[model samples]
Structures are given as structure tokens and as C-alpha cells.
Target: MRPKIYLFGDSITEESFGDGGWGSSLAHHFARTVDVVLRGYSGYNTRWAVKVAERVFGAAEGGGGGVNNEEPLVVTVFFGANDACLPNRCSAFQHVPLDEYKRNLRSIVSFLKKRWPTTRILLITPPPIDEDGRLRHPYIENPSNEPERTNEAAGAYAKACVKLAGECGIPVIDLWTKMQQFPDWKNACLRDGLHLTRSGNEIVFEEVVKKLAEEGFSPETLPVDLPLITEIDPRDPLKSFQQ
Candidate 1:
């Protein structure tokens, strides 16, 4: 079986398989070498992720929680955008307190480590939010005209995520900080001020691949699953296909 990478998170991750999406880019980059799996849930937060852990990762039976018996090459934990929603805003239903958010993130990392001891776990911080963009592309009705989320709130969540990753000794993609490095990140990197745009997807794809490469999963490092035509002697092609 091919090695696999799993993605877990909220809307941003759920839509990662779309056209020009980072997930799709990864799939293409690793085609014929590894399988990329998606396990994203729209509108979810760390708190809810912990709640559904048993379901996503089957009950702790026979040692490995049952997403699969094979240990994945990497697994990404990305949740926070929604967790940063203001408690009194339209997205209040999904609001989770800052303290609880930190606890939930730790719970998730612990859960993954238990499930795949040898797998590389990567954490991704939530990207910065554009208040005007959110208002323009509202996910929910905002009659009060107040943004359900704010850049400040999202920054707090991102900081917590980065700190958690450091404490846990895992690599992290600090999208919040990285995106802001671009002058027009609000429009260039994010489509709805929260989700990624094509350029944003490009950034994610590059970062993920770069990180995975450092962890020894580069294209040159991975063995190809099947022989390319050039690898076969035209006169004895069958020999190259021997399993």
C-alpha cells in the first residue's frame, strides 16, 4: 500500500480538495508516491474535534485507533478560525473560550500521537482574518454589521497554536504570521478573508511540501510505486513490471 498523509480540521481543510486548493496540489506533487487523505469538517472547532475523535479515529481497540493500521507519513491538525469567533457574534454558537481552545488543541495532539506514534504530526495556525472581507462574504447573516470574527481574536488563537506546537515538539505552519508578511494578504491569500485564495493555496502547498521534504519525504527520497517507461528496457518491458 502507498504511504499516506491525513488532514484534519474545519472548513479551510474541508475545502482543501477544491480546484487550485493546497490539498490537491499536494496530491499532484506526491502522485504515484503517496496517498493524501482528507478528513475535514466544515464549521468545526478544536472542542468539536475532540468530541468526534472516537468516531473519526475508531475506538481505542487493538492498540491503534482505527483510521488505518498503517502509520501515515504525516497528519496535520488545523483548527482555530472558528474557535476564534466572538462569543457575542453571529458565530457565537461555534465560539470556544481561549483557555478551552488551548486544552482542546493539546487533547487533539495527544490523540494523534497515541494513534500514530511514528507519524510526523504538523500543526497549522489559523490565517489572519480581514474584517471587511468577512463582512462582504459573510458565512452567516450579520444584521448588526459587526464581524463575527476579528483579526485580533484570530491572532490570539494562532499564537496559542504555535506555542502548543513548540511545547509538543512538532513542526507548525504559522500561516497567520506568514500571510501577513504579504502586503495584500487580505486579498491575495484569502478569498473570504478566512479561507484561502488560489495564491493562498499556493503558499500552503509550498510550505507543506517544503516541510515534508525536510522530514525526509521528498520526491527524490520516496521510492516510486511503479516503474516509469524510461526505467524499462523497451525490449523487455515486462521485466520492469515484476512485483
Candidate 2:
């Protein structure tokens, strides 16, 4: 059996766009040769994930715990998408201020670490946007709720996450920078400049694999049932699509 890694997060983590989510891509990348658990919820923020964790990892087997006493579990927390939705969720960046967002993120990590002291924790920064990324919806008269999906405010949130992870002694995958490097990357990666697309999911998978390798995690030790996807969309001319 391979080590069990649990992913907890919102739509981007859940791969709601078919196989366009990072979690799905990650599962495909490792599932063919390792063990992976894809547990992602749509339209949920970091706050919601707490509820899921409480149910699965609150106590031990004798008391509704997340541990099975038979497998090594690794938990990865990816959030802050919906929280950053803005406008509708809040009054344009009022809901999850950088400080509050950081606080919540830190709280989640601290809780999980305390619960599973031996588990590996990975903190992923939310992806970028096209124009109006901050404004969530229900737009009324917010100047920031136009077509500009690229939320400059998101950078603050991402930086806070990195800083927090560093303080907590955990690893972070900088998806923000990776996405920027791709050509016309926004189109292939995200459906609405906010959500991820099939190609975007591939980028995440690639990054996760690289991170695991950089951390000295040997692929051989992973389970055989891990999802290993071979190809993506071939119709697109990009080499990203495999066989």
C-alpha cells in the first residue's frame, strides 16, 4: 500500500470542471503508481474545510477520528478562492482582508498539524485572474467589479499565505508564478480567468510532481494504484497535450 494523501479545499481543488482541477490532475499524476485521496468541495472556502476536517479527523477511531491506524496520511490545504470572490461575498475586499485571510489560513494549518502531528502539510497559493477577480458577484456599484479579473489584492493574500507557511514550517507551491510564465496561459488554465481549465490543471500537476521530487520523496515508495494520467487535450497545438 502507498501513503495516503488527503486534499481538502473548494472547487479548484475538487476539479469541478471535469478533469480541469489540480486535485484531479494530481490524482492522475500519482494514482497510477501511488495512493491519493481527492476530497475537494465546490463553492467552499477555508472556513468550510474546517467542518470537513472536524468530521474526518476530529477524534480517533474510537471517537470519530481521521486516523485509520493503518495508513500514513498527508494533508494538503488549498483555499482562498471563494474567499477572494469579493463584492457579493463582501463589500469589495471586505470579507477576507489580508489579515483575516491569513489568520484563517493559519488557524486551519495549526489545527491540522495539532491533529496530525506526523502528517505533511502543503500550503498552495491561489491562482491568478484575468481582470475583475476580486469582485465576487451581485455587482451593484463597485468600481472594482468591472471586467478586470486580475485582482491585485490577491497578491497580498498569496504573500501572506507564503509567510504563514514559512512561520508554520510547511512547504508551499507557488502556482501564481508558474501560471504567469505560460503563453496565453490564462486561456488554457482558467475558464473565467478565475477558475482553472484543463491545461491549467496540467500546470498544477507538473508543479506538484516537481515539488515532491525536490523534497526528496521517492516515487517508488508511492502506491501502485495512484492516478497517472498520460495525456491531455491533443487538439491544442501545445506540447502540453501528451499521448
Candidate 3:
């Protein structure tokens, strides 16, 4: 039987299976060794992800009593994105506050460990934002719809998460740094400079695969050609030009 991997994350993971997020791409990458079960939601924070553990993995929710005896081999927990973002939809500039963000991430990891005692956890950081402080838009023509949120601050948040994950003895994927090295990362996001493009999703998928391999996860066969959302043309108005 293929090992089951329970994925807990935010929008980037959420978009994978639906319209082309890294989560969906991951399904293909792990097809040879593990079955992917995505439990990601848009706009959900680490705090909220902990809630899913109670809601879906709890006995009252029709899950295994307190332990996940069913699938115990693998599980990935990713949530800092929304947690580091503004609390409500009302303000785009507001954030969850750095200190609180750390606490929430700790809670999320602890909760998963308590439930899935033997599961392997992989914590992923959100991607980097464009350095110019300007975001690209797909449908909208102006930046009025989206407010400036600090990508620089995200590095600190990611490090905090990495530190916490270390306490839990889990591996982490530094997506922020990887995206920064990409020549087109700045111009690869959708209308907003936050989300990733199909190519971006591919980059994420590759990184995860490489990390999993480094962590000693060797699958007999890996799936490579999973369809993704439509690709955006660089010259298109919806696409941003970094150079």
C-alpha cells in the first residue's frame, strides 16, 4: 500500500489540486511512493490549521479516536502564509504580528505530533514577494485592490517557523529563498504579487521532491506530468515584468 501523506497548508497548497497549486503538483511527485491527501484552505492560518486537526481528525468528526492509526507514515504541515498575513480581509496591510505568528506555528506542529505520533512532518515557508514593493495584477489594472504587505518581514517569519520545526525535529522547505533565486519570480505571480504561477508551481514541486529525497524518501516510481492551470504569457498585462 502506498504511504498516505496528509497535507495541511494555506492557499498555495489549496490551489494545487484545484486550479494548479504546488499541492496538486505534489500529488504527482509522490504518486510512486505516497498517496497525497491535501487539507489546505485559502486564507487559513496556522491557528486555523490546528482547528482542522480537531475538526477532521477528531473522533467526533468521524475520525480515528485520538490517533491516526490509519495513515501514520507521512504528513506535511504548512501554514505560516495566512498567519503572517493580515487578520481580516478588511485590511491588506495588517499582519498577524510576528510573535503571535510564532506561537501559532508552534501550536500547529505540536497538535499534529500529538495526534500522529509517528508521522513525518514537513514545514513549508511561503514564497517571496517582489522586491519593488509593487505587485502584478491579472484582472485588476491598479494596485488599489491589493495593499502593500512586507515580503521582507516574511523571511523573519519563515526563520521563526524553521526554528520551531527544529524543536519538533521536523524538516523544513525554504521556499522564500528558492523563489528569490528565480529569475522570473518577481513577474511570475498572478494579478497580485503573492500567489505563484504554473511555472512557479513547478518550481515548488521540484524543490519539495528534492527535499523529500534528501530526507531519505525514496519512491519506486515518480509521476512527472501532472496538468496545471493555463500558463500566463509574460507580455500579457496580467503578467508582471521584473526586468
Go through the candidates in order and give each one's C-alpha lDDT: 0.90, 0.66, 0.66
Best by lDDT: 1
The Cα RMSD in angstroms, rounded to one decimal, for candidate 1 relative to the true structure is: 1.8
Give one digit per residue, the lDDT tens place, for model 1 in 1-243: 889999888988899999999999999999989999998999999999999976776666644344755778999888999999999989999999998999999999898899779999999999999999999999778888999999999999999999999999999999899899998899999888789999998988898998898889977888888897789989988998885
The alpha-carbon lDDT assigned to residue 3 of candidate 3 equals: 68
Q: Looking at model 3, how many pairs of residues clash?
A: 5
| Tens digit of per-residue lDDT, candidate 3, span 184-204 | 667765325677778778777
Model 2: number of backbone collisions: 22
Candidate 2 lDDT over 165-202, as tens digits, reads 89988889777767888888767677676777778887
Write down the TM-score of every candidate: 0.95, 0.75, 0.75
Q: State candidate 1's TM-score.
A: 0.95
- Compared with the true structure, the alpha-carbon lDDT of candidate 2 equals 0.66
Count of residue pairs whose backbone atoms collide, per candidate: 0, 22, 5
Q: Supply the TM-score for candidate 3.
A: 0.75
TM-score of 2: 0.75
Candidate 1, residue 47: the lDDT equals 91
